[model samples]
Target: MELSGKGGGSRERAALGLTFVLRHGRRTGLASAARLLQLFDVKIHHIETRPARMPQNPAEDLEFFVKCEVLDCKVSSLISSLKKVAEDVEGNREGKAPWFPTKIRDLDRCHHLVTKYNPDLDCEHPGYTDPEYRKRRAFIADLAFNFRHGDPLPRVEYTPQEIATWREVYEKLSSLYPTHACKQYLDAFHELEKYCGYQADSIPQLHEVSAFLSERTGFTLRPAAGLLSARDFLAGFAFRVFQSTQYIRHSSSPMHSPEPDCCHELLGHVPMLADKEFALFSQDIGLASLGASDLDIEKLSAVSMHLILLGRYRTNERTNKAYGAGLLSSYGELMYALSNKPEYKPFDPDVMVIQPYQDQNFQQIYFVAEHFEEAKSQFQKYAMKIKKPFPLHYDPFTCTVEVLDSPQKIKKITSHVKEELKSFEKLS
Candidate 1:
């Protein structure tokens, strides 16, 4: 059976009950599952089966539409039962399944921005389609191709020109960090300089920086071909992984980069990732992005962009805080973003999500978080509005994502780990 369009059946659904779309591997006793739901007074509105896209093993995909005119608790129980039935059908499944919102997985199918060839630069930058730029793009794609989870990060040998570009941006941004940057950023920056070879006349490799962040905040960096769609990029944060580029911006525009480069990733973003509070805040935004509708994803991306751009503005009335890597890394844009000209408001997800953004010029509006903890608290509350079915956690040892299928699973894993830690502490 086919479901009706939004306008046709949405009001009816709301008035009569709420409709939930449930999906699982095909031929998993879906008919039996539907009959069981009837025993609980669940109204099975529709059922459909389709081919699984890139299934691990050959199995059809089944979708069920269930309408329930019951209290919220009852609806939740119904969903819990459905999940159990789905799990039971696939008996003795080995290895934990990586679960994410279907919409987020859909993004993986699209090619990255760096792989696409567009000749029109439009003042964003020069030589996007030039021979040199194309060669650089190929180098980035190679790095991305070689990347594998649970393996050591691959190294890239920088050319003389690339090293020079890194030196120029480094020298310029380092001079401004003492006064313009926040305390957390300053601390992390000092650690990076001392331990990771973040200095003028030298380029810090992605592997080195990733190791630094992993040691400090459980965050790791993966090389990207270039800029990823906001959806794709933010999704990485959910797993405590960051998608970074190894290429420097064109030497001609050392102070400005239309797209994120190694300078921005290493200087602007990496330091914040080292701070536990800020890293959690970043992950909160990522969690919100999963399972979001297309319109919601666009809005969330706008907010992500603004946060990265305006994270470190200096205001006379309040304490100076720099949360965005873009603002922290760019000497020119940092000054412009914190200047008196642009409008400033408290960080509101509702307002920032729909606010317009421009890539050609500095943003005219900025969202100011009072502090990292406040930002984390506020963003966590906002993230609850998003409709996601499962909770996700990263396993550093395996370098894999584990989807918590039930509350019991979350408790079992987390509690067991906690008990082990307690035992170790007692023995010590």
Candidate 2:
């Protein structure tokens, strides 16, 4: 946290500090950035680096923190130039909010975020005892770690056992789609079957499915090693990206998966992504996550229990269906949710946002909305209700979060909205 000066002018020209991570190879970029800062007559007050090592790779990264003071007018130019050189430049929060990604490529900074249940960390994980399964998981994790945005999605050759495991999940969920799945889920599921070759016999490659989605809704898939913490997972939704896992569940547990796998993504989320309205809902959750405080982010990630708003939908007293990816993917939970067993409640954001989630079993209570569009409208209203110091807009094209901090910025967004409305009126 940064301390602000008392007077207005002092505040305007206050010392600006940034903390960023850099690799040994990027030291030249750091030197070039320092020279550029000198051009703005910025005074470098302090500089430091601390080692950040992973258990897997002891030589991972050294986080660099630098504090500088520069004139008000030159701040923008200096920061812009710094952005061009640094991997991620985070502003001091009390003096300035720490940075989130400003573009699609910037997401590389997020690749190494903390996770709750990693294979090496959690001995209770299903694959922990099986050396072969552990090796397979590590192989896939390496693929994801090396992958970048524009690179061709890595293709995994599923072993016979892996495919057979996926087949069981596919057959079980497909059998229930007709009776228990929502209208949106059913429609998209069939299209995925027709176009992406979503079948029980085999696993559809991520590249094939990602391309299919990009054409329809602009939502695309990226490979993930395993279950990401909720903050990291939901963060991807802001950019219309899904961090999906390519590995299948262990063959012994074909009826269930403790973590996200190919089954959860292919059978559950892939179909839902085909629906445009649902795509909007996904980004809404992701957009709210950007620029949020750590406390607020924690609340948004777990409380947003996307399943509460996204998964269950009830059109009328007699009709309830599974629309959320969590519900659609789990056969046991799907049947349990639609049964007369669990407590059903109205979709009240204030109430639902505080509810605790227990991941091991079926949720005891479920929140349902009338349908997707209305649910989205209701959820957006609730998301807007989260009071922040500044508002933000996510540009899907640039994949950046535009902070409405200045009057000019706010007015520009307002003017753009009015122009969009005028275009709509012309259509009418």
Candidate 3:
């Protein structure tokens, strides 16, 4: 849960990158490339890749696409490898065991800790404490379960130790955390993990985890980290009321229904958070949201796009790598992001925050962070712009997308039209 010395030994571990294979033009090296990637523990699961042009734009760059039939075995193996990487990082962090605090009472204490110990970290609390705020939070929380868990289940209880562990992470993370912009993100994990306490069966390894979403809570069954929980909150922002369907689609399925399952949530997003540099980078961006205007929120959405696509865009070896959970879990996305074919732009948080995103398909454009520190410094310099105790604009749709009374037939039709087009495209 609170990995201490992840990426231990600082052997200069690299982020993951896209792996492009010209399925049509160059089959010659495809096998070797795939083999080499396998040697690197990278996976190549897509079986039906092809070069295709954009539907609307005739002149847009062509892209390689795939709809591989992934067996549970292969997926499980991929997950094992990824989990190994994540575990290695976490083990390393624990070895370091940086002096993390156990608890905090308020934002002032939170601030002092951040400035004193983690000046790089940012925190936010989306002023959701008013009655209306409580109602909204409850509504979102309820909807999140509805879509995922399917019933008003009994309250889940946390063990004294598990509760204490979460309290410890929350306290340490909250201290010096700067923006409430990312509160929703953090809360998503907190909320789900709270569900874990009910399902726990006296397992100690699982006990150390405080906030865990059960299989009932609209995700594939797996233990995920808080950051991934936050990313899942965003990906499923609009689908908070229905159960995360277990029926995975085959290559024959009409649309890319890569269910936003626990594998994607935990495997894709959480490891990067294990990286101190990336964790602080995210805190900085989240802090930017506190003072963000509606325009800033809009721009921040673009920033999310930039981060998602960067998981794939391959530039320099460093620039080519990604820590995003989305790319980590999917063979298709992992391949595309590591591939050099896609255009890679310089990482620019501000410009990215303003860039328009296509919610219907994979990103065609991406920005590359110059260095982890560049992202960190960017947040540090702009931390002031991030407002404290930020306010949120309400979207009736965002608030209630999953709760509308609609039959499965109509719901499927509407999802195909609006959500299915968008869901897998955006990686949290």
Candidate 4:
């Protein structure tokens, strides 16, 4: 249970797994890496090289994932040696610890946690000047602010005006789904309508939809008062939890809102989260954030927001479709992203982490992936670049993070993996 070595004192027992990314400028990324490992008492366990391209360099470079064992006392020296040849080094033994949810009830602790991206309505907000609307908004927001994990999800009785707004947005989007939405989204949407009461006449209640989604994807929704801090929102995915807004957007701007409203959450995100790969892609972002530093978190925003912004557009005659919640929620932006007008760039995490985002405008460029699996694979490679000090694993059955910091933890997890492989072998 101890990771106090700092790579000193005892050299006999502790074993560490290390992965480092080589700098692009150094063409000798592979050769130099192997040479560095031999310089220390390091025993290489497993090694892999994946050819990947970055925006800065047009040439392909190798991504080295090295699993190695070093004398407990010499771990630091090995890391230092690797750093001389590698641009960044990641070892699973040490780093910062961030708060994480380990049980279903533990989520209650985050109920009132606000990472406000302007928690209060800005003047530019559509209903900012309407006191009556503000009152209604606050009433719904309170349900989320006061929410506890086990409490019934707050149900809203839509007024005629709210119904009218819902009808307008629903009709517009439903008509386009046949043409613009991905197949997985359409399938999820129909099931939601059939089982969870998704329709034009009334807004679907969070409780029913939450139950429907949880049964399908192990993902459930909790209400959020408004825009959650990127960090808080992203954290939910680690536990298959999604923080959704309960209030509908202002009726005047039913088609567009500067912030996420219930319209966006239910229409844009809910159905998409039901897709298994998309859900896993979302969890990858959360998994990457555990024990991540502030600067690392700031950079993660590039992919986290894109969880709903990712799209797949084929250059061939096949239809281009939108998979992310961000684009699917907006009628106009969805059209723009799938159209021929905007620049299409492959979803490169190294490039996207630095891309700028605006709450008010449509993204000028859309990141394209052939499917969620490709996006998931590429993003995971990018996630390793996140500076989490130790490795983490999420156990869905228990709804907790299993930190692999001690030998006991490592052995316990390896046994689980071995059991999984055994079952898979029989199926195969």
Total clashes for model 4: 2
Task: Pick out the ten consecutive residues of candidate 3 with the lowest summed lDDT.
Answer: 105-114
Span of 10 residues, lowest total lDDT, candidate 2: 51-60
Q: For model 4, how does the per-residue alpha-carbon lDDT over 312-417 read when each residue is reduced to its tens digit?
A: 6443455578877878888888888777798888878787777787668888777787665777788788887776557888888878887788888889999999
- Compared with the true structure, model 3 gives a TM-score of 0.35
The count of backbone overlaps in candidate 2 is 1
Cα error, residue 16 of model 2, in Å, equals 12
TM-score of each model, in listed order: 0.68, 0.80, 0.35, 0.75
The pairs that clash in candidate 2 are 311-324
Task: Tell me which of candidates 3 and 4 scores higher on TM-score.
Answer: 4
Clashes (backbone N, CA, C under 3 Å), per candidate, total 2, 1, 42, 2
The local lDDT score (0 to 100) that residue 209 gets in candidate 1 is: 91
Better of 2 and 3 by TM-score: 2
lDDT (tens digit, per residue) of candidate 3 on 242-306: 11211112222212222343233333344344343444455445434433344545555566545
The lDDT for every candidate, in the order shown, is 0.67, 0.75, 0.35, 0.75
The residue-level lDDT of candidate 2 at 84 comes to: 76
lDDT of 1 at 342: 82
